[model samples]
Target: MRWRDTDKSSNIEDRRDQQMASAGVPSALLMRLLPFLLRTKIGRIVLLLGGAYLAFQYFTGGYSLEPSNTSGFSQSQSASNGQLQDENAQFVAAILGTTETVWNQLLKGRYVDPKLVLYRNMTSTGCGMGQAQSGPFYCPADSKVYIDLSFLEELKKLGAPGDFAFAYVIAHEVGHHVQNLLGTNAKVRQAQQATDKVGANQLSVGLELQADCYAGVWGHYVDKQLNLLEAGDVDEGIAAASAVGDDRLQKMAGRAVQPEAFTHGSSAQRIKWFKVGFASGDIASCNTFTAK
Candidate 1:
């Protein structure tokens, strides 16, 4: 929570000023190439790395990939004020910087820094069109994390208010980047594609819970090495994990809480895994895939 004076990450891409008018539709060439690339084992790498580069360039105004005759978009400046001094943006950058430090030490020089993209309303990403409603996500294709500052307001609405809670969210997304580095995301995606809906949901829950544990692993480092956590910070983080549980969100929406429908695990499972990583400070202990 002591982030105001902390260093901010230079890897942050500020796209708040660039308003994406249409959902980023890929160029025809890219759409045709991706499927072909995804078919082979080695090609998956090219698919993620190369496809992402072309997609990012197309979406971020490198060139107009769409035809001029298409009715999809027009150029216009963002109406939202995209200021650097915005307190929330600074907080996000500082947390990202902290994650960079933790991950560098943890990965031991193998870590390539992932940029965090800050956008307002909607944006184009390597994955696809990013909307605020999707919350924060790590797009492994581009090696970036996409977030809308407005998501903090939504987090507060979910009863997870506190700077540490927000930090946990950033760390969780960064955790996904870690998974991407470890090839966990790719394995899960492969498994998901081959499984039934319920089985795929189970795989998703493991993936998400592992990310939660990774977040706790980062928390462990910050508390032990950096000495940044104050009293009750862990509680705030657990509250955040609880607030975003599949069961909790389903209940909030007044839907029947179905275990089969859960994608991010139950509240107890999330809290448990986070504690596991926090207690151990070891990534090896975060094997949610094999845990009961």
Candidate 2:
């Protein structure tokens, strides 16, 4: 949590000002109208006409069906970017820098630091449109991590607050980057393809748990080598890991706890794995795939 004085990372891509344009028709509305439109001849004719008009516009460069922004970057958002840089953005860069330092040393020249993107609302990513509602994520396709600062507020609402908690979230995404670097993600995807739904979910759980462990490993170095952890910092990290557990999230959403549907494991599983890595500070000991 003592990251204010740390160096900011140069790998940050700030896209907070580049807001996503609105789509003409919300996808949900289009889905709702689709069945009715397909059921009648007149409606079918209307659909055909609409499609033809859109295609013609596309070919003629008359209009675009894609989301469009009249003004590129809104003035308010551009101004807000300055405010973010003063604290939030700097904190992110510092945390990322620490991760880069730790992982680069841990991997011994094999680690390729992934770019971290700062965005607001939504943004285009290598994996597709990244949305804040989905929280932070690492896109292996692009070898980058995307985060919306708003998610920090969401984390606080989930009962995990403080700088170290946010650091843990960042570290977890970086852990995913490490998985991608080591080809663990690809192997997991291949295995998932060969399995049933429940089996696939189990694989996903293992993958997520491993990331949590990796985060703990990063914490280990940050605490032991850098001496950044303060009193109650570890608790903040644990609370964060627990807050986002699939089971806890499901319960919070008023849904029944279903381990079979869990992709990120339960609260206990996450805390246990994180502790496992922290206790050993060894990647070999962090493997969740073969663990009972």
Candidate 3:
């Protein structure tokens, strides 16, 4: 990916692996937030099991993540801020700075940089208890991005590759940030609150698909302006889009593919949207609502 020497995103918040290992999360908030996730006994069991698994990982080595340059990080994979100093952190922030430049120029407005928070196990966010299990997410409340560096390895295992894949993930989250800025997320949330289960799921699919498109838009200029993409970079992104499709995840989970249960689009839809934004590099072209 040639990322070791390239400009890192200023928005990045790498905590480094060793320090993250020291930051074991507690369970009090999980108990408090249990009510939001379920109403049934079986659901509660699932939640408890997930929490226990996260706890085990926090203390052990599951959450360990290192930076792209792993010269000093050897204790674990978790990106720990305590063990890592400001230099590594700047590497991430530099990458984010590039994203801000690309997206701002693309969007033609002052780019509001989302603070990419680097934490171990769990951290306080404007949203509810932020944990590694939630994967990488954007909190609209505070306009911040969250991620666990261990998930970089997870992405590779899932078939998403290279630094571009990481950039795609960030851009996709930033896409959600774009939706928040454009009031698309609020509109979707409002419509969801007003609708039944299936209709709301449809809205979610649209929203997620649009984020894929937004990521592609970021990819377009990133290649044009920075010359960062090598051959097969775009293909890697397509592979990633396919990898995270609801259908693929469902099959991996050993569940029957239920279209209604899809929060993210199918493999075809995700790839199509990302490609749409990539080829066009126009925000207006990412109107999944109209296309649908």
Candidate 4:
């Protein structure tokens, strides 16, 4: 991918230096003790006292709930990490800027650029606490995308490597932002609410496939308009899409290929949809909801 020459996006929120912390008591520990606390009078008293103590501490600023730089690292190690993070941040910003350009042009003034946040380990989002284990995700509630760059390493481990592959991942998340902007996400949520588990999963599969298609649409423009793609770049994007396919992942986990359990469709489905959008470069042709 020819991204270094591209302009970096101004919408990036870098929170990689910070880590979320609990105040007074950890929420997980409190939840674990809740049932015991409610079962006995002494436990209830203890719980009440604990709650009062926490409240007093909070009011007096005895503990902080804000994200803090708590990493205990040597200066050399910190410097090294900082350098790598800076490079990765620049790459992310460039890709996001390309997406913003394409979407803004396509939407013709209706597109709102979504904020992309770079964090390490975990971060607080509009959708609640986002963990690195969950990979990258877009939170519609905040109109932002949260990503832990470690997932890029994870993608390499999943057999998809290269800059374009990473760009596809970012584009896919941005595709979800487009869905949110066009009200497609809300409509899908409403439809999901009206369906059973299997039906809901099917809707989820459709939604995910649509995002893949949208990513391909973005890829088409970037390659055609900006000349960002090089040899084998498209293959990397396809491999990245296939790497996370529901069926392929389930098979990797030694499970049966159950279409009913799929929330992101099969590898073939993903590749097909991506190709559909890439081939046509048309949003109308990318609709997976009504496709057979």
TM-score of candidate 4 versus the correct structure, residues matched by position: 0.83
Given candidate 1, what's the lDDT at residue 179? 96
Model 3 alpha-carbon drift over 4 Å, by segment: 12-91
Which prediction has the highest TM-score against the true structure? 4
* Clash counts for the predictions, in order: 0, 0, 24, 0
Error of 4 at 275 (Å): 1.0
Estimate the lDDT of model 2.
Answer: 0.85
* Superposed model 4: Cα runs more than 4 Å off: 24-85
Per-residue C-alpha lDDT of model 1 across residues 196-267, encoded as one tens digit per residue: 999999999999999999999999998998888999899999999999999999999999999999999999
Clashing pairs in 2: none
Per-model TM against the reference = 0.80, 0.82, 0.75, 0.83
**What does candidate 4 score in Cα RMSD to the true structure?**
6.0
User: What is the C-alpha lDDT profile of model 3 across 137-250, one tens digit per residue?
Assistant: 889998988877666777889989776777788789889988998899999999999999999998999999999999998888878877778898898899888989999999
Candidate 1 vs. true structure, TM-score: 0.80
Clashing pairs in 4: none
Expressed as tens digits, the lDDT of each residue in 35-102 for candidate 4 is 98999999999988877876677568773335445553221121222343467878888899899999
Cα error, residue 89 of model 4, in Å, equals 1.3
Q: Is candidate 3 or candidate 4 better by lDDT?
A: 4
Top-down TM-score ranking: 4, 2, 1, 3
